[model samples]
Target: MSGRSAAARVDEADYIVVGAGSAGAALAARLTEDPDVTVLLLEAGAPDTALELHVPAAFSKLFRGPFDWNYDTVPQPALEDRTVYWPRGKTLGGSSSLNAMMWVRGFAADYDEWADAAGPAWSWEALVPYFRRVERTEDPADPTQGAAGAQPIEHQRDPRPQTAAFLDAAREAGHRVTAANLPAGQGFSRTMVSQHRGSRSSTADAYLRPANGRPNLRVVTGALVRRVTFEAGPDDPAVPRATGVYLEIDGITRHARARREVILCGGAVNTPQLLLLSGIGPAEHLGERGIRIVAHSPEVGEGLRDHLVAGLAPAARGGTLYAAEKPAELANYLLRRRGMLTSNVAEAYGFVRTAVADRIGMAADLPDIEIIFASAPYVGEGLVPLPAEGLTVGAILLRPRSRGTIRLASTDPRDKPLIDPGYLSDADGIDAETLRAGLAACEELIDTDAMRTVTTGGWIQPAGGEHMTPVERAELAMRRYSHTLYHPVGTARMGTDSSSVVDPALRVRGVSGLRVADASVMPNLIRGHTNAPAIVIGEVAADLLRGRSSSR
Candidate 1:
């Protein structure tokens, strides 16, 4: 990937992918594998050259920093009217560069619902090949695991003793020990991270950077895509098609045309925001903002779903990952990329069905909540600094019932969009009740003999909830301490329904030569982390585009 001078410009390419993120990087690299297809990859942020980006334990340091798109949501009603902060990666690897790097595939039923919404092509069985195609696991002989793939995913090499205790506590609390990526298992396992030899394996490192030198691929950094440009031929005035992007490069506005298609890989938030900015969203919302609407698609920024977690942190008897912040650990990381520096913070996790699931009429087969056990206090959604040596047990609602919206604060491309996650605002109050149950479950796990062996103090954040009832304590803790798990999806959902922004093939419904290939197209929230599945989405999108391009 030769660096281009600020004055350099590419007038056109066979394909243009906006956002050189987890999905975009993979898509661009895969498309360029066909030497005939010239691809232009545009990234808003500068190159990811910082040392901390590759270090696993340093992920939280990037939050709200220069590399983060540091967005905040509208005040939520259920959580004491608190505004939540969201950290999205702005660099070449996107959020993959900034995220905890946990590799989770979600449940099989999650894709079954996707297939039901889209087609059989998105079924769990159908997506296995793409999953395998995107991941390189440690076990080559294992049929379920990938042997040789672009992304490196490995089991936690050296889990902290506290992590093992959490797993033991989970077992004592009635959950089973499960495989790393089992779709049906409602139990605990050490986290599988997107890393190789202990360092982060962001899509930039796994796919884009390795493939950047290819003659067919041109990567442009610090290019902020303002809007997608659509044009019509003189012969077909009514049928306007996506032509390229209007981008800002080093303070200069430039246009880059696409000969084939313009793909949006800007994830759930930015993709919808860009679509609205490009005049392709609901008519009334666009009109209200005094912006012209090219496509009156009502579902452009609707159906926003995300996972919200309430942290239950107990002071630990043993030392926490906070010790890794010292200079000696830095030396260890620099020398061998091992030790506490390799920790993803969220060291172990489990899926569990709480009693509230039956009350809320949730599916029995689907887990209602996820417990991510961090070796340190991951408070304030990893935004707040750790106060002391503690173990954090995060109770995450797997599938929220409430829906939210992403709206335009204004037409300005530089302005951040209005993000309203509508967290715990389900009319039926199911979301809140389910989360309350999850909190109770977390308390149960913490109170177990296994956890008691490692923990030192009582509830850290709730302050005085020790004497309160489990339900009351859960309610208090949830109301005062809940935050996003950073897994927002479904802003521009893909479905067969007319309300969907994209079709089953991921093409924008009202626009030709344009498609969304990221979390924004998810019809529903999945049951696990989004990183690995997002890479798979890119692989599937590349195949979909290639199939159509080949036919033509």
Candidate 2:
């Protein structure tokens, strides 16, 4: 599939899935399984089967490169007036190729809240089979699990010494360490990566590549979708029903009709933007932009949520860190698929309650914050090499109460949308008490006997010192070190209400033959990294399109 000329007015298909990312790949693979269902997948970026994408540690290089969309957020007032950089995948595998390969299932209660918020079928108990179906866990047949049906899920084979040390430190800090993706009561543990052997198993590698040769599937790269074209009646003042998509490839415009459905898998930001561009958002906002108002769905691009993380670097012993520049290490990885090349950096993590009680307080079974420990610091500010020897830990606040919005920059599809995460802007807004408690947890872990062995002084901001008062430290932490956990969701939310862009069945409200199958459809943010759940959404959407019950 190389150097293929753009064909004008391409052939029609049973389904047109946009964005060959995590969700799109899964949906395409599942839909094409039925040979009768012709599926056409459109991707704005080219294929990335490069060695760089396969190496787990090389993910840093992929960011802001040709494969990435390279988006930036408006200045976030909460983080000391800093503008955060958001790197999303625009390639064949989408963000999965560029993301940390941690296979977190979030918390069980996370899905229960989904059911309560979105609909009943979204609950943990109801969605467990889908999770299990799409996962081939490293340890299967334990009744607790097994890897049998979908993608391969395994623990890192030779975790960096620092990863083990971090786990030991957590134990020393009086926090129980357990497997990260287990059932709710199993407690906290190291992350189980979505890896097959030593290589990163991106959605393209796991699902798309294998389906490449299928006669029923046609994957067109470098095609940028401008808007969904609707079939309209002459006298009707209402929005037309979507029957196809208008796209451009190599300076040529074309349209492909979908007999069954046009699925938008362009991710959170792009999905909402596409809908608004198609004239299906807030009536006033659309009309103000000189665009025709369609459905008038006020919530088309509302309810944006993301995980905010803060990084902490601690001293490390010599010979512990993996230096990719070293000849010996690079050769080892290149020849044997071992050494630093296989490392996903963020190899260990744990979920714990920052406060004594749950943040929601309705259930006794949930954890508030999740701490992700990396062997090396791969932060948004770029990779900061440790001082000859040091390690870093990232504390992420999952399930933030803060909400944001995604609005169109203009009617042009090429123009990137305005993504305002509005981080930490909750009704209560920046909670000093919760942040201080989180800091205390971090302090406890660093003060542990295991961590003390390699310790230097604490590296808290504010520059006054680690001994700064809790108030001072909290203020400094808030201002100095907040960053994205890379998990963004809830832009095009799903609900039964009229304001929602999509209904519970994942179908667009007031739009015919169109649906959204990606993180954007999530009514609320899940409690962990969203990569795995995003893939599951694609799988479920495929089943629904094939007339299978979502309960399956």
Candidate 3:
């Protein structure tokens, strides 16, 4: 509550970072490592004080709750005009606190693709050190996994027995059971989570908590940044220099001046929305909003991509997350910290190269689908709790060909943006085809003897089971069951080209003294979960500002 009763009329800092979630928390913490440096991290939501936030299996209970941004997409034509729920975290750790905690790093080629768009600085080899700097893997099976980093990356302490059955089903279904997050060809493995003991270890817990006592670092919660306040560039008046931000805290408007630079760590949705509100996006869009144009970056909110997951939940016999909140389980979790409550719903996952991607000659290393195993019925997009015990096998479209946009609905900063992921809107219908292949894979897993042993022959998701035709089943899954896996990227894409929103160094084009250090800057969405990469981005941004040169 530092911001609730502070007498900060005009707060000043060396670096002003907007949105103290995954990236901002780490960035502010790392920057303040130098005693001389000063940093101000602004978070719109309150602290991570929710009791449910500490419980891994209770993550879904936060969806659309106070801690979540509670965003929704514009009706998608391809999705039968369903307004898909897109829940983002509004609190200290941001989405990382609300996520399933899957620590998936994807493949080397994904970062190499980023290198192709930006520079060698973004290549997998170049980013490995940053990963090492951010992750402290408790169980490092591979030499590549980090051992001495800021965040705790540990395997799930108490994954469900049904989760193990799902992995066995993968093997029974003719899939290789290998370690997850492999640089190339990731196979089935229990998900490594961002946890410590049994509680969630978000960026707030990992970076901010450790740096709380730093005098030079100031963290202001419940601070909603309205726009970036700019001044005439030091060199030229035509170009604007980001001097600070205009933020609102508890209905009081305040100006926090940045002496050196302003960094946007607002993630994919908020970053572009802030830019457009500040007249830094497309000139036409700004004109329509009656906002003065500060920059003409047309691609600020374009190139939207996300991992879409459709789940098939079958009724289970017993021993699922359904009883996680039972009295006995609650007591066990509270006292021993060893129970279903410690389970990060999605306990196991793997990457699979679908026939659809192979037909298009996609890279062998870049899989088209990701299979996720959950111990509970993850239906209704985790918003509605099912009454019965069930197991979920989620099929994720890893590399979606379709593009989308994030645009302003109104000039008000509080109004949510129009999120149009345009899922399965490709001209050739390849995106839909790829998802169909993924659905078939999900069916294969559920049909296995190992899966059959755990799950009863009853279906919980789609009322109809094996009676529907393959094409009909896939159509049903795509139209009715698919939802976002919470990974959205490329809204403020960075690349070597001029049209890109930011350059290779993550500096915003057409503006100086401003940079973006979140998933919004990614030129392309990786094949894995975005949490690991997002934290690494903050670490890399810290090095970028500190002038710590990278060898790769």
Best candidate, lDDT: 3
Per-model TM against the reference: 0.96, 0.94, 0.98
Candidate 2 to native Cα RMSD, angstroms = 2.6
Residue-by-residue lDDT tens digits, candidate 2, 1-552: 331227523668989998988899999999999999999899898877678888887887777788888888899887888988888998888998888898887877888777877788788877777887778888752353536756788878667876777789988777787765766754556778778888888888888878878988888888999988787623453545678899889877888898877999999988999889988888888998887766778888888888877666655554454475588877877888788778787888887776534544735766667777777644334434334455566567766778888888888888989989988877775443455566667666766788777656654233444667645655565557667878889888888777788888898887677899999998877768899889989988988899886454
User: What's the TM for model 2?
Assistant: 0.94
* C-alpha lDDT (0 to 100) for residue 244 of candidate 2: 80
lDDT of 2: 0.77
Clashing pairs counted in every model: 0, 7, 0
Consecutive 10-residue window with the lowest summed lDDT within model 1: 1-10
TM-score of 3: 0.98
lDDT digits (tens) for residues 1-552 of candidate 1 = 333435556679999999988899999999999999999888888788899999999999999998998999999888899999999999989999999989878888999999999888888888877877888987542365676789999877667899989989988988888778875654688888999999998999999878877889888888889999988734566656899999998889889999999999999999999999998998999999887777789989999999999887788885789798888888888998888999998999988888788776777778989988899987766777788788888789998989999999988888999999999888888888888888888888989999988987566656555666777778866887888888999999999888789998899987788999999998888999988878888988999988832112
Q: Against the unseen true structure, what C-alpha lDDT does each candidate score?
A: 0.86, 0.77, 0.88
Q: Which stretches of candidate 2 lie over 4 Å from their true place?
A: 1-9, 141-146, 233-239, 320-322, 356-362, 383-388, 430-432, 458-474, 550-552
Q: Cα lDDT of model 1 overall?
A: 0.86
Winner of 1 and 3 under TM-score? 3
> What order do you get sorting by lDDT, best first?
3, 1, 2
**Compared with the true structure, what per-residue lDDT tens digits does model 3 show for residues 1-552?**
123223443489999999877888889899999999999888898888888988888999998899999999999998989999999998888888899888999889999999999999999999988887888998687777789888999978888999889999989888888876678767888989999998899998999889988888888888889999999999998889999999987798889999999999999999999999988999988899899999999998999999889888888999999988889988988898889999998999977888888899997656899998888888888888766899888789998999999999998899999999999888999988898898899988888999988989887877666577656767787898899999999999999999999998899999899999999999899989899999888888998999986433
